[model samples]
Target: MIDSRHRRARLGLVSVTALWGVTFSLNQVALHSMGAATLTFLRFLVASLFLLLGFGLRRSFWQGVNRAELLGGLLTGSLLFGGYLTQTEGQRFLSASLAGFLTGLSVVLVPLILLVLHRGLTRRQFGATLIAAVGLYLLARPQGHEGLLGIALLLACALFFALQLVAVEYYRITTAAVIRFTLFQMATVTALAALVAMAPGGGGLLPLHASQEAWATVAINGVGASALGFMAQTWSLRWLNSIEISVIYSLEPVFAALVALIALHQREGLAVWIGGIIVVVAMVLVSITPPGGATYPQESST
Candidate 1:
C-alpha cells in the first residue's frame, strides 16, 4: 500500500483542487470591479512576488534555470497570462459558477492534446469526456449572465490552459522546481501584461490603482489563485499520476458551487446540481487507474 505521506499528497491534491475551486468565487469578486486586463496584470504581479518569496524559501530551486527553461518559462507565462486574461474578461459577462464549470472542461481537452502528441487515450477517457460535456450543457444555464460569446471565450481559455499544462509536463522540470518555474512564468506574464496595458486602451482598469478593492483583488487572485494554487497543485500531484490529478481537479466546479453558495450568495438550481453530478460521475468513470491519454484536467483555465 502507499505510505501515509503518499496518501497525504493525494489528499493534498484534492485539497488543492478544492482551494482552486474556492478561488473561482474570489476571482469573480475581484473582476466584478476591475478591468480584465488590469486585474490580470495585478494577479501575475502579485503571484510573481510570491514566487520570488517561494524561491527564497528553498535552495537550488532555480538550479535548472537554463536558456531553454527561460524561454519556455516566458512562453508558458505568456500563454498562461493571456489565457487567464481572456477568462477574466469572459467572466465579466459570465457567472462565476458557469465560468468555473465550463473552464473545468480542460480535462476533456488535455486528453485531446495528448492524442495529438501521440499519447493514445483509453475508453475511460472517452467516457469522461462525454460526461464532462454533458456537465457543460447543464452548467451552461440559458438564463445566466454568460452568453454564447463568453462561453466560446471560456472554451478558448480552456484550450490554451491545457496547452500550458501539457507543456509543463513535457518540460521535464523536477517537481521540487515547479513553484520556481511558476515564479519565472509569473514574472514573464506580469511584464507581458504591462506591455499590453500600454497599448492604446486607456489603461483598462489601471486607473483603479488607488482603489483598495482592486488591489485586494490583485492580492487574492495573484497569491491565492496563482502562487498558492500552483504550490497546492504540485504538492498533491506528486503522489498521483497526472491523469488522476486531472480527474480530481475536475471537481473544481463542484467546489466552486459550494464556494459560491457560501461566499458569493450564488444559487444553483436542480439543473446545475444534476449537471454537476453528471460531470463528476463522468470524470470518475473516465479517470480510472489503467493509464490512458487524451484526457486532462482543467484547473481554472483557469
Candidate 2:
C-alpha cells in the first residue's frame, strides 16, 4: 500500500510539473502585455477566488483550519513568493537558458540541505543528483559570462524553492486539510503580488493594455497551474519526500521544451534532447532506489 501511494503521488506531481510547463510556454504570450508581478497578481487572484468558491461552500473545510495549517501555509507561500520574485527579477540580467538551469538547481539544493539537517543520503541519491546536474547544464547551454547579480538572484530562487519543499514535508499537512492549506498559500501569494504590483514602478495592479490572449492565458494558468497544480502538490507531499519531490520537479524544463516543440513548433538541438533524457534517467533512479533511512512517515489517507 505504501508503494502504491508513492507511485500515485509521483504521477500526480509529474502531472503538476507538466501543467507548469504548459503555462511556462504560455507566459511568453502574456508577458508582452504586463509585467511579471502584474501577471502574478491576476493569476493568484483568480486562483484564490476559485478555491474559495469550490471548497469554501463546505462548512467542514472551515472547521479544518488550525494554527499548524496557517503557519505551514504562510511559510510555504512566502518561500514560493520569494522564488517567483527572484526568478522574475533575475531574468532581466540573465539569459533564459541560464535562469532556468539555475532555477532547477533546487534539485541539488534539496539534498545538500537535507544533509546539513542530518538527514540520510544514499549513493543512489548522490549519483542521481550528479547526473541531473549535468543534464541541466547541457540542456540550458548557457552562453556568455553571467552577471553576479543575476546568478545570485536565481540561486536565491533555488534556495527558496528548496526550502519550500522541505517545509512541506516537515509540516506533514493532512489530506483533509490540504484544501485549506493550499487556499492560504494562494491567498498569501495573491496579497503579496498585489503589494508588489502597487510598489513604485510596479506598473499598477492591472496592465494599461492587455491582449485578450494574455487575459485568457492568465485564466487558464490560474485554474490549471495555480489552483489545481498546488493543491495536487500539497496532497502528494503526504507520500513523497522533499528530495523526491525536488528531483521530480527537474522534469519541468523538459516538459516545457517538449510543449514548446509540439505546440509552438519550436526546434531544439541534439544537446537538448540528450539532456532531457539524462534528467529522465535521474528521475527513474530516484523512483527505483530504496531510501537509505527514514525521514518522515507517510501520512495515511483520512
Candidate 3:
C-alpha cells in the first residue's frame, strides 16, 4: 500500500512540474495580447478565487489566520510578485527555454542564500553552486548583449524566488496551515497586482480587451499552475522525501525546454542546449544534496 501511494505521489508531482513547465511557453505566447502587470494581476486573481472557493469556504479557515501567518503571507507574496512580474516581462525578450534555465538557478541560489544566513552549507552544495555559476556563464555567454535586460530581470526573478523560499522555510507552515497560508499569499499577490494595474499607464484591471489566447493563458496559469499545482505538491509530500521531491522538481526546466521546442516551435542553438543541460545538472546536484547534508525543504519553482 505504501509503495503504491509513493508511486502515485511521484506521478502527481511530475504532473505538477509539467504544468508549471508548460506555463513558460504559454505565457510567452500569451504576452502578445496583454501587459505583464495585467497578466500577473489576472493570473493571481484567478488563482486566489479558485483556492478560496475550493478551500476557503470554511469559517475555520478564515478564523485560523494569526498575525504571523498574515505577515508571512505578505512577505512571501511580495517576493512572488517580484518573481512572476519579472519572469513574465522577461519572457518577452527571451525564449522559453532560456527563461526556464535561468529561473532554475533559484535551486542553487537557495542553498547559497541559506549558507549566507548561517544555515550551513555542505561541500556538495558549495561545489554545485560553483558549477551552476559556470553553467550560467555558458548559458548566457552566447547571447552576449542580446536580451541583456531580460537576462537581468530573470536573474532578479530567481533571486526573489530564492528569498521567497527561504522566507517560507522560516515561517515553518504546518500541514493544517498550508491551505490558509497559500491562500493568503495568493491574495496578497492578487491585491498587489491589482494595484499595479490601477496605476497610470499600467493597463486596466481586466484584460477584457485582450485576445482569447491571453485569457486562456491566465486561466490555465491561475487554476492549473498556481492553485492545483500547490495542492498537488502538498499532497505529494505525504509520500515523497524532500530530496526525491526536489530532484523531481528540478526537471521543470527540462520540461519547459522540450515544450518550447516541440510544442511552441521555439528554436535554440547548440550552445544554448549544452548550457541548459549543464544548468540542470547543477540544479540536480543541489537538490540531491541538502545544505550541510541536513534535511531542508526545497519548494517548487515559479
Candidate 4:
C-alpha cells in the first residue's frame, strides 16, 4: 500500500486543504477587484511561471510528456477552470460560505458519476454521501427559493469539480512529470479566460489598477492558493481516496466561514451556525472513516 508514500501524501492533502479553506474569501475579494477572466489568467500565469522555472532547471523535466499527455493535462485543467468559472460567476449573487459548501458538493456528485459510468460505488461511499447530503442541506437552505440562480451555478460548479476529480483519478498519464503538461493546460485556460474577459459586455477585460490590494490578492492566489494549493491537491490525489479528498475539501467552507467571521466581521444566523457544525462533524467522520477503509503523492513538485 506504499505506507510511507501514503503518509506523506496525506500530510500534503491537509496542507492543501488548509490553504484552500480560506481561499473562498480570497477569491471573492479578487472577483470584486478585477475582471474574472483577468484574475483567473493571472493566477495560472504566475503558477505556470513557477512550474516552468522550477522544473525546467531539472534535467529531463519533459521526459514523460507527449501530445496525448498534454491533452490529458488540458482536460484536467479545463474541468478545473470550469469549476472556477461557474464559482466566480455564481459569487456575483451567493455568499462565499454558501458557495464554498455547494462547491464541496462535488464529494457527493462524484460517486453519482461513477454510478452512471456503471462502475458504481461501494455501499460505504454511498452511505457516507447521504450523511454529507444532510450536511449540505444545513449549509444551503435558501431564502424562499429566491437564490435559485446562485444555487444553480453552485450546483454546476459542484458537478464540474466532480468530473475533474474523476478525470484525475483515471488519468493514465504520468501524474508526476507534469510540469510541461500543466503549463499547456494553464495556457489554454489563460487564453480562453483572457478572450472572455476582453469580450464586450464581459467583465471589463483589464485589471483594476486603482486597487493594489487586488494585485496583492491576485499574486497571493496565483502563488499561494492556486499554484501551490493545486500542486498539493493533485499530489495528494495520487495516494488518497476520493473520499479523503472530499473530506478535506469539505473543510474549505468551514474555514471560509470562520475567516469571514473573525477577519471580515461577518455575522452568522442560527441556521448557519448549526449547519456549520453539521458539516464540521461530517468532515471529521469522513476524514477518519475513510472509504473502503483506506487512505495520497503529495510532494511540492506536483
User: Scored by CA lDDT, what does every candidate get?
Assistant: 0.69, 0.74, 0.79, 0.67
- Which candidate gets the maximum TM-score versus the true structure? 3
- Over all chains combined, what TM-score does candidate 4 have? 0.83
Candidate 2 least-lDDT 10 residues? 287-296
Model 3 / residue 30 / CA error / Å = 0.9
Candidate 2 wrong stretches, greater than 4 Å: 1-3, 90-101, 120-142, 145-152, 173-176, 265-296, 300-302
lDDT of 3 at 179: 69
lDDT of 4 by residue, 1-302 (tens): 66887788777776776666676777777677676667777777777787778766776876755576677778978887888777877776767677666777776676567567865566655666667767667656743364567778888988888888777665532443434555665666666676777788566556656277667777787778777776665656657766567666766776767776666676767776676666556545534544454534243233
lDDT of 2 at 294: 41
lDDT of 3 by residue, 228-298 (tens): 77666555554554445656767788989999999889888888888888888888888675345444243
**Model 1 pairs in collision:** 107-296, 111-294, 111-295
Candidate 2 global lDDT: 0.74
Query: What digit string (tens of lDDT, one per residue) describes model 1 on residues 134-160?
Result: 777876766455476788888888887
The total number of steric clashes, by the backbone 3 Å criterion, in model 3 comes to: 1
Reference-based lDDT, residue 278, model 4: 66
Runs of candidate 3 with Cα error greater than 4 angstroms are 1-10, 144-146, 172-176, 234-245, 290-302
Clashing pairs for model 2 are none
